[model samples]
Target chain A: MSSTHIVSIYDEELKYLSRRISEMGGTAEQMVADSVRALVSADAALAQKVISEDVILDNAERQINEKAIVTIAKRQPMAADLREIMGTIRIAAELERVGDLGKNTAKRVIAVQSSGMPRKLARGLEHLAELALMQLKEVLDVFATRSVDKAKAIRERDDEIDAIYTSLFRELLTYMMEDPRNITPCTHLLFCAKNIERIGDHATNIAETIYYMATGSQPEGERPKDDTSTSVVTADVSEASE
Target chain B: MSSTHIVSIYDEELKYLSRRISEMGGTAEQMVADSVRALVSADAALAQKVISEDVILDNAERQINEKAIVTIAKRQPMAADLREIMGTIRIAAELERVGDLGKNTAKRVIAVQSSGMPRKLARGLEHLAELALMQLKEVLDVFATRSVDKAKAIRERDDEIDAIYTSLFRELLTYMMEDPRNITPCTHLLFCAKNIERIGDHATNIAETIYYMATGSQPEGERPKDDTSTSVVTADVSEASE
Candidate 1:
């Protein structure tokens, strides 16, 4: 075969590999969502399913990596192509981590069940999980479409999750404070919140990865202005009120 | 320059870059240790010093990146050399994060001082910081030497840190339970313990990265073992005790 034909074959293979990776990302995101849902709802069956499905995600990751290696070995792809392969490898690794997070959430759900926690706390957890899932879906959309604007919007959603996490932390703190009996259950719920928050972070990481792939630049999030005038006044007022 | 001479120059430059990265790692590890010491001992001067020295670690990271890019563009490194450069980039990033952890600990110390928490709680937090610092030191040693055995040993140390974290959690829980007035200070200490625990996790991450760089194989840390028998026994014993 001519060198050009070989190059064409490798290009085709690269396209296939890229699509496979994106599909794997989709599956992993779903797994994470489902795992969180299981934890929030105490769906033992769903938790088990998520744990078992992890093998499929693992397989997808392995296949993507193998294809990348084979393409590199056979085609000796240069700069831009090499970057794409590397990005695919990194995204695959990140997606695999997402799958692990899902499995961890599922395991925590099992632990919480075994610990005999009250089920009423699941309502807030379910809300947090849904928000995290929305963020993951948006991030995957950004990845699939290479939508820079969408990626930025998804990045903004991280603040929403952060706010939720803060509220959840305070709520759980109050729960534990109300009674020592609430400690173990609240702790488990706190871990569930943490796992969901981490899912949001992973989605943010995907957004950053998308931004890098599209522009070869890291997007710096705008830092909150350090204008301390309001904070100062508030501190003084609180002191005066005290 | 002849191609051979250019290659020689590139090799030397790569070696120098790696050496500098290793040196930065050493500095970061030391900074973490001293920052924890300052926090535990309530050494205001040492805390201030750590906050200042963070700039040096930041500069080292910048230098490492600049050198890596120069070598990559000029030397045209092949696959293995490229992986080495990439590893250095990642290692530098991790080291920068370690530096940030130190700065964070120092900031927390200052915050605690400002809030006028009891000096006794600082002692417990100091022990937590020491545990974290020890784990980080071992992780860096493992990274510098690329000792798989050492990496495994560092993983064990992480368990000790986790144990300390659990006890610290219980201690903080007791404080918060004692009086609602104690909530703010105890919560601050809890955050301090959490920061230390997270620092230990970062160390473990670096250890995992080192294992990858040294062996070019993923470590098996995430697999769920079937310890059903132990779990059952423990469950029964706990039930009986309860």
Candidate 2:
């Protein structure tokens, strides 16, 4: 094949990898939304569906790894090309974890349903999930477009999710304190809130990856974690702020 | 340079990555051991050290990413060679998380010590950390050697950690139930136990990566997570298992 043919083929491989991540990201975002919807409504079937469909995200991650590894072997892409492949692997893994987080939340839906629903918490969770899913969708687009500015902008929104998480945590703790029966279900919901917060972190990671792909450097410094209330333990008591 | 020289150079790069990982693993392992010691002894200074020293692990992970990315771009290795580099990135990330887990556990030492130490829980945490640290060390060796047999053997022990974790969960919950004052400290310790459990998961990920590097394929199915106790939410009522 001519050099142009070889270049075009390599380009196609890269394109295919990006498209897979976008699809995976879309699925992951949907999972986040659906998992919360399941939680809020106590919809067992939708919850189960999210749990079952995680394997699709798993398979997408596997394919991305295979393709990226093979592409590096075949094309020996340099500089930006290499970062793009690495970013793809990183983003796919993030999306896959996002799926797992959503699935875990879905599982919580079942647990809460079995115990009995705490209706007030559901509204808070839905609000938090909406913020997280929006971050996920925007970060994924940043990945696809290599938009560092957009990525940085998305990074700022992690705190919003964190702030919601903090408030919900305190509210859940009060509920548990008020009613012993609330303990088990609230414990489950506490973890679910953490799962959603983690999903937000994964989105932030994707944003950082976008920054890395565009600039050949990761975002400097730790992304601020503003949801301080649920910090189970840390050296700084300040991190336990409400 | 002759092809021989180039191959030798690539070999050196792989060796360097292996050595860096080993060093990082040792630091992570020590962090685990030290954190548990801090917990058991109520040594705030040691706990403080682990918390502050996490920046080292962070730096190690950054270096691993830089080295792996550059090597892939320059060496453009195929098959097992490519898998090795990818595995390094994955392992380094896992190790970094291990460090974070240890650091978090150390933080719990401070939290619990401030409240008052529950002596019995100390022994249990020590035992779990020992198991997890052992797994971390052995798995890092498996990664270096690409020993499929060793990796598979390590995967089995994750169940042991999970079992310990499960039992520990019950013990802590009992503690929380017994005294209202115990709730905050035990809650702190529960999250610490979870951090250790998660460290074990990272070891399992290394085992999985080792399997993939050896055979160019991931393990055929899900690694058994015998940690039925920490199933915060699940479909089965039985999952609130003994």
Candidate 3:
């Protein structure tokens, strides 16, 4: 084959790999959304689907890695092309963790379903899930378009999720205190909220990654302060009450 | 200068950059530890130190990025070296976040110092702080040694911390229920526990990154399921009594 032909073949392979990783990100986002919904709706089948679909996400991660290595070995890509490939690998790994978090959410839902908590709690959880899913979606959109503006907006939403988490936590704590019987279900709901919040955090992580990839600068945020007051005082009353 | 000499200079620059990032990691780790101690002891000066030292961490991140760009543009590193550079950039970013979280914890300390809570509560929080420090130390050790086994072990400790958090949470809740006035202080403690827990989580994330750098495999350990039946029932009973 001509040298040109060989370069073209390598180019095709790289493009194919990029598309695959992007598709994987899309699927992982969907799984997280479904995992939350299944937990909220007690949809056992959807939960099962999320659990099983994790294999696909896992496979995609493996494929992205293999393809990158093969391309490096054969094509010996340099400079910008190499950065793109490495970025793809890093993003794939992050997305894969996001998928695992989703699967964990699904597993928790299954466990909660078995414990038989009231359905009302699930409705509140659904709100948290929606918020998380929306954030994830926005980050994915930024990745697709490489839009720094969109990434910045998504970063701001992280605080929103944090605020929602506090309220959700208070609500669940109230439920558990009202009825010991509510503990199992409330705990399940709490985990669901946590999963969603974590998903939001991961979304922020991805957005920051995107920001770096595009602008080569860290996302601007006020340096986080090292105060224990908010956390300590919050726990103190809860401890006293308990 | 000869091309060969230029190549050597590039190599040296990359090495220097790596060493600086490593030093930054060490400094950030120390800052986090000090911040936690400050919160536990209410040491205003140490808290101020943590906040000030964060400037150094920020500068290290900026230097790493600048060096990576210079290396990429001037030397045009090949695939593996390129991956290493990118990985360094990403790891530095994660470490920067760890530093910010530490600062956030320290800030909370200042915010709650005047809340008039018992000093004993700091003991529980101190435990969390120790756990986070240990995790951070382990993760950095794994990074330095590239020990997959060490990374795996650190991953397990995440679960242990989670268990502590659960018990501590219950204890705090009980305290709040016992005296309504304890609510404010208890809430602060809860946030401290959470920040420490999150720091531990970030440490685990770094461990996962180390694993990826070493073996290209995602770390093990599924997310734990939430089991809150006992706590829920106890909470309910406590509420009824109130």
Q: Which candidate tops DockQ?
A: 2
Sort every candidate by DockQ, greatest first. Answer: 2, 1, 3
The collision pairs in model 2 are: none
Indicate the worst ten consecutive residues by lDDT in candidate 3 chain B.
B224-233
Off by over 4 Å in 2: A230-242, B230-242
TM-scores for all candidates: the values are 0.76, 0.91, 0.73
| lDDT by residue for model 3 (A71-172), tens | 765676656565566567767877887887788778766556655555666666777778888888778778888898988888776776677776777666
| Fnat of every candidate, listed in order | 0.01, 0.25, 0.20
Give the DockQ (2 decimals) of all models: 0.21, 0.38, 0.20
lDDT of 2 by residue, A86-201 (tens): 98998898899899888878877766776666667888988888888888888877776777889988887788888888788767656655544555677668778888888888
Off-target runs (Cα >4 Å) in candidate 1 are A48-78, A114-121, A220-242, B23-31, B34-79, B96-124, B147-149, B155-157, B183-188, B219-242
DockQ of 2: 0.38
Q: Tens digits of per-residue lDDT for model 1 on B172-221?
A: 65555554444444554555566677777777767766766666555776
Residue range A1-242, candidate 1, lDDT tens digits: 99899878887987897788778878887888788777766788998999898888888876786576556655656555665665676677678778877886776666556555445556667777888888887787777788878887777667777776766666665665555445445555665676677777777767876776676666765622211111111112123223
Q: Model 3: runs farther than 4 Å from truth?
A: A1-7, A42-59, A69-80, A100-124, A147-191, A211-242, B1-7, B42-59, B69-83, B110-121, B145-166, B173-191, B198-242
Q: Is the docking of candidate 1 incorrect, acceptable, medium or high quality?
A: incorrect
Query: Which residue pairs in candidate 1 collide?
Result: none
Cα lDDT tens digits, model 2, B1-242, are 89999999999999999999999999999898898888778898999999888989989999999999988877778888998889889988888889988887887676588666666788898889888888988898887777898888888778889889888877776665454455556666777888888888889988998898788888765677535663544232233323
lDDT of 3 by residue, B1-242 (tens): 99899878977986886688679778878888888788777888898888778788878888887787667656656655655665677678778878877777677666666665556666777777777788888788777777888887887777777777767766666665565554455555665676677777777777776776666557766743332222333424366334
CAPRI category for model 2: acceptable
